[model samples]
Target: MATTNTTTPRPGGRSARVQAAVHQAASDLMALRGRAALTVPLIAARAGVTPSTIYRRWGELSDLLADVAVERMRPDSEPADTGSVAGDLIAWAEQYRDEMSSEVGVGMMLDVLSSRNGVSVEGRLPVPCQCAAFTASQIRTIVERGVERGEPVPVIDTVMDTVVSPIIFRSLFGSAPITSAHTQTLVAACMKTARLLAPVEL
Candidate 1:
């Protein structure tokens, strides 16, 4: 299951400020007191909002934590451009593996997944795997660059299944290390699949 966005409407003015404060409180509490110590009332007290505000906006503590994780994991910049499709894929894959396998990364992933079956806050759109959306967006950028350079690029699903999915699976479930070598191996497999998919001249 992909991580989905349970993005609510981003109202401006006081509402945005309140939302930011609430998210910050949740993040701080998670870091300071840990997940086992958190509750909606505790977060609301820290954020200077009533518990009702939180219930009205996020529905559950898990959903709020997921929202925070999604925001924290959002890419701050475009993927590194390494001048070739293979270089780009390897660089991106290696970094992806490193980040997702880290302690912070694992926490974020679990937070997002914990909310998978939870209810959306009132007036919020149901999350449709925002976590995978983030991954897909980056892959699309890389594929577009490959196309502009006349390089054969695997379709998004191919890249997701061949490269990203394995990395995620190993990071979350497998006890095996997700090494740089392993990432490059996955990228190589994805590129091989792309080559097979490319049309050949008669």
Candidate 2:
């Protein structure tokens, strides 16, 4: 007996084209006119799609903005290689703090949080979120590098919980300034955890 194939075909043709065009248009407009000036009609006009097209796909402006924010936050390159795990963590943490604490970063963070962000056509949530996934990928790189050099390193979740989460929480709530010193403090705590968790040789 022959089995039936149940795979969903990848999104393409007109749907893919429209999505690409709209994403590009939204990004360009956000850069040129800022987020406050954006509207579904303006983006549709720029993308050569009807406002209904966007509404049909994304449901609302906040969801559209969240999708765009996820795209914009995708990492273009690997985290900086600063030799030791501690150095790498320090560098990555400081950079992450600076970016996420900026006016634009804060806005993007809010956009991602304000909606479902990127839900697949199958209705699945992005789980860890695309932005958080990107951050985790960077941390994985740092951890792998440390392991390669025989240095003890905390797991990815340790870094995320210790360093990334605090920065995000503080940035979003404005509980404290995300200064370099604050980032360093977080990194130091992460490294301390790693040291304590390291296995003792027989």
Q: Model 1 over residues 24-141: C-alpha lDDT tens digits?
A: 9998998999878999999999999999999988888888888888787777667788988788888888888888888778888888777744436554335446677778777777
After superposition, the stretches of candidate 2 with alpha carbons farther than 4 Å from their true spots are: 1-14, 116-126, 195-202
List model 2 lDDT by residue over 3-59, tens digit each: 011222435999989988999999899999999999999999999999999999998
Find the 10 residues in a row with the least total lDDT in model 2. 1-10
RMSD values for the candidates in order, in angstroms, are 5.2, 8.1
